[model samples]
Target: MKSLLFVMIAGLASAAMLVSCGGDGSKASASGPFGEIPSLVSDFETFSDAKRAELQGGGEDNMKKILGEMKAAEEKFKESMNAAFEKVKGKEVVTEIDPELPLKVVTPMKIEDISVSRHLVKLVGELELTATAIGFDSYEPTDAFELDDLVVLSYDNNGKPFAYDGLSKDMGGEPMPAGSKVPVDTHIHIESYNAASMGCLSKILITLKGSELYDQAKAAADALKGK
Candidate 1:
């Protein structure tokens, strides 16, 4: 279960971030250049509140149900994305599901130095996270969050999932005061490999997690549900 936390989180993220761009570059309503383009992005605030309500209702089954929805959404999203790409480009694209690592944690991350060439994109960035100690008996006062590697995933205007396992030796941070927000630097090098496979960049995603902390958080969540 600990190893699969990210699969669940990424499912939620992917399910959350999918917004419709347009079938073609046309206006939906007649007042503007192409009329008003309709927004396909789901209302996240409302979605989030509903999820919160589910949590408050308190059951492991409820939690499992949400994860089930996320997995279903993931499969559906990938299918729709491939279908759309087939319409735009003639080749079939294969999307990969990242395995849940031993540690599952994601923090607020920002991408910088995003540059694009005919076949590649590169960037420097950092993840904002706090080192935490939980379970009075399990707390360690001097623990530091060690960033071993970065997991990258994203979708284009068409919803195709592009995931890259970004390896970095230059990213990590020193142990800081407990619960202090710190920025751990990282980088990514993504290449489209060919022009036809590459579309305009619509979104970028990064996830980082710690072993002990990830399990700790899950326990807390389960406890909240009275499990």
Candidate 2:
């Protein structure tokens, strides 16, 4: 019973973060893949709360029914997200590891898969990394260069550049040793209206974090606000 409650709470938290909230205390109209998320989350919350309260009366059949409902809702949510992601499956983006950058890309980065929900687009891929002399200087030569010290930039079809929302790699916090090729799984986030257009990206640039290029890209992405 406790385990079921924990799962329900976790699902709620995950769903809450996946959608945007309106300023007023009302459900915001979604414009992307997760259009039904707000209502789904609300329904699940209400249903779970009612079920939890009933569980206090100790009914095994009630608990089983709750579990079945939870699973159904979860499957429905996944189907919605999966269908949305399918719209962008074959679209390819040209990925480039900036030559002037300190980090050396031993393997070319490619968009192996994509996932979209609401305004967030996630790009997944694998790449190999090694540090150069310049990398050493930029990343404190003695210490291992961490994957978190990487920056990603994406451009639309019109060639307008924007900074990505965030990046995550397999060996995230660990130091990337210099002169050795290390394979890292990468997941990058970018904000967009839909998966199709975002998947058809013109280009993606990767550079060292905190570089001047990153600042410029961030500024460009930020300037799009209100427009």
Candidate 3:
């Protein structure tokens, strides 16, 4: 009888220990309500390992050629982004004005001072984008004056920027000039985007005008901690 009681207590303690050890606090074992995707480092390492395997099995010339192509593609992408950036420098637009495209946002930028009206949503913010090309004249600005075309996006707790695909697609072309007052309808839409890419980090803004979509804008702003 004594031995059985001791075993039962030991079993309960072990079970409790296991529950605590395997709780949601452990990243390796903690699955959220939905599981998480692997982090960026895991993705990079996977690609790097595959590339190394190919290099070891193949000729040096092929490896060199592949690297060169990667470099060229990166250069072309940077050039295109720089061209888009150049078109918006020295521009200021009121949120209440017509459909003005939002400015581009790279990493390390903070967004703020957003207001909404019936037909306009005013966004005043700054960005922290690096110069894509060296020879551009606009790159030589003082730190205080560094902000170019300012764009805004609503970010969620996971650091992911969220906006509707339809809205972003609607602003496919060049947006109206900054500060140009144009009458806009409701539906808080995005005014600029890159359609081909997964545009979570792309330049975009959320409008606060229109009738039915007002709540969405407010929700987005609230998600970003706006009062």
Candidate 4:
């Protein structure tokens, strides 16, 4: 009886030692009220290998489900990345000015202020572009300085003509005296520009032509040069 009592006491002591030594304070409880639910492992590194395996559970079906969820999450992330990449690639490039049509050509008729927005553009400049006839003794060459005819050429990012916009100025061939100057302001509504090659107008070219004075002015200047 004493031996039996000793054996029972030894077994109880051994059980207590085992319980105290191997305890990790955590208790086994289902993550949810139901059974297993597929979960996203945001920080898989935080869990031990054994704990992670236990969370995944022990079945071919469970393993497949976990892998499928992870794969789906990875694919979703990749798709979003690709979408952002495409947006960056398609972003519009800005153009400052058209080199072929420099502002210096209209020297005295300068562009004072310019504003651009997503929808429209506003431009302010001198209306009357000065046309100096070097050696014209008569006022016949003065009409070219009036700029009765003005044409605008709008270009896109690719330097292709997009819109043929008209200025709001009322020059209308109103006829100005020799060396007369006029100031003008104009606005262009980009949305209203209905052209085949139109996307975003990156450059604008303003041209003035005095068809009648072209040969006459050159002849006067050449005559003066020869003398």
Candidate 5:
């Protein structure tokens, strides 16, 4: 009887260990290349909740502290995402836009080139604005607009679509007059896990400022799902 009881106790202890290792499905397991993403998201959510609660309590010092914490969390999340992307960096992936749904831009712009990778999509182009579009007769060349002002949409090969609100950086070139075309080199970061999948960026939609085509482009992009 003593031996049997010892055996039963050992079996129960083993089961408990298994349960603890598996957890309660509240946190994601660090398995796949992108597995850390879910945990990062959970952490960010927790941080956001804490920030909101602290703000509600209403203290200037607390607000500053929360803001600093928020910035650090954001940077950490970005670094983690970049690390994940680096894993699949040089993989051969198709970056072809759909021929059926050609890019339609009412504004005067030209996309000369597109380079895609796991982490970023770069667009090399030129943009020319009309006097009417700028609401001015003539204006000197300047960095009058940011790449974030444009509307961009991306679709995976499976037709899963993702939308991006600008988020471009390293846009190089001097600004030109309203009627003169200015060279634009814009790099847009891919933040979504779904958007980072292989063969993503199969379709792309880019519209310039003052184009008034966001709603139409969004509807078309959304329709690509399940196709």
Candidate 6:
């Protein structure tokens, strides 16, 4: 479950961000240029609150049902996305599901640096994340956040994932005070590689700073989702 936490989170991030970027490209609208995933995030928030309400009401079975429903929603979102891409590019795409690596939305921050080339588009931004202990959920004292790692993601019209190794494989941190937790921050960089296949858009590549403390991880995630 721990390993798959990312996959779940990524689902939320994708659903929310895409919904937010609907055709308008106007921030004031319920959906932006990205599509309808942001609305899903809002719905998830409501669902979370409802789940909590159920727990308070001693509805454990209800909680399980809600979880199942959320999973179904994610699947539906992907299907809808595939269909939409077919309209934009005029082809169907094959998909690969990584059951082990669910993605989570780190923090909702505005992204910039969107660029386009003949057959590709690129963007860079930072991910503002709340840091917790390495193996615990409690926030670490003294060093509560990070703001250094940088990420970069790219997408070509061809469907293939790309991984880039950074100059530093590991990000070192400041000395921790006794009992202090690991520092976490939202300044990570996320690099993505996307392509249009069978007229559908898919993320074929994703690269991020190796450590949770890098400033690039967030940017990469944003680029992937934004595209």
Candidate number achieving the greatest TM-score relative to the actual structure: 2
Tens digits of per-residue lDDT, candidate 2, 31-117, equal 322233333344444555776676687678877877787677667756765664565444344567767643555554543454433
Model 6, span 1-227: residue lDDT tens: 88699899999997755533322222212222222323333343455566656666556687687678767765665565444323333111122212212222232222222211121212222221233212222235644333233333222123333222221112245532233322222211221121211112233222235543223434433454564
User: Clashes in candidate 6: how many?
Assistant: 63
**True lDDT of residue 89, candidate 5:** 39
Cα displacement (angstroms), candidate 1, residue 190, comes to 4.8
**Regions of candidate 5 where Cα sits further than 4 Å from its true position:** 1-53, 98-152, 156-160, 164-186, 189-217, 220-227
Tens-place lDDT per residue, model 5, 93-127, is 22332222222223322222222223443444434
Model 1 per-residue lDDT tens digits across residues 50-166: 666777776899888886775565465445434432333321122222233222223323333222121122333332234442211223444543444444554344554333334
Report per-prediction Cα RMSD to one decimal.
Answer: 20.2, 15.0, 18.7, 31.2, 14.5, 19.7
Estimated TM-score for each candidate: 0.30, 0.48, 0.24, 0.30, 0.35, 0.26
Tell me the lDDT of candidate 2: 0.51
Evaluated at residue 47, the lDDT of candidate 1 is 43
- Which digits, one per residue and each the tens of the lDDT, describe model 4 over residues 1-227? 99999999999997754332221221211121110100111112123243446546778777777666656655654454344333332222232222322122322222222222222334555533344322122436452333343445544434544344444443434454445454444443332112112232345555443333333333432342343
Q: After superposition, how far is residue 172 of candidate 5 from its true place, in Å?
A: 16
Question: What is the model-wide C-alpha lDDT for candidate 6?
Answer: 0.32
Q: How accurate is candidate 3 locally (lDDT)?
A: 0.32
What order do you get sorting by lDDT, best first?
2, 5, 4, 1, 6, 3
Per-residue lDDT for 1-227 in model 3, tens only? 99999999999997754443231222211121101111111222344456667677677798897677545654654454344334433333222211332323222212211211111122233322122211112544432211222223433223334433112111212223333222221222322121111112233344323423434634544443323
Better lDDT candidate (1, 4): 4
User: In angstroms, how far off is 149's CA in candidate 2?
Assistant: 1.9
| Cα misplacement distance, residue 227 of candidate 5 (Å) | 24
Q: Against the hidden true structure, what lDDT does model 5 obtain? A: 0.43
Runs of candidate 1 exceeding 4 Å displacement: 1-120, 133-146, 165-174, 178-197, 208-227
Better candidate by lDDT, 1 or 5: 5
State in Å the error of residue 143, model 6: 33
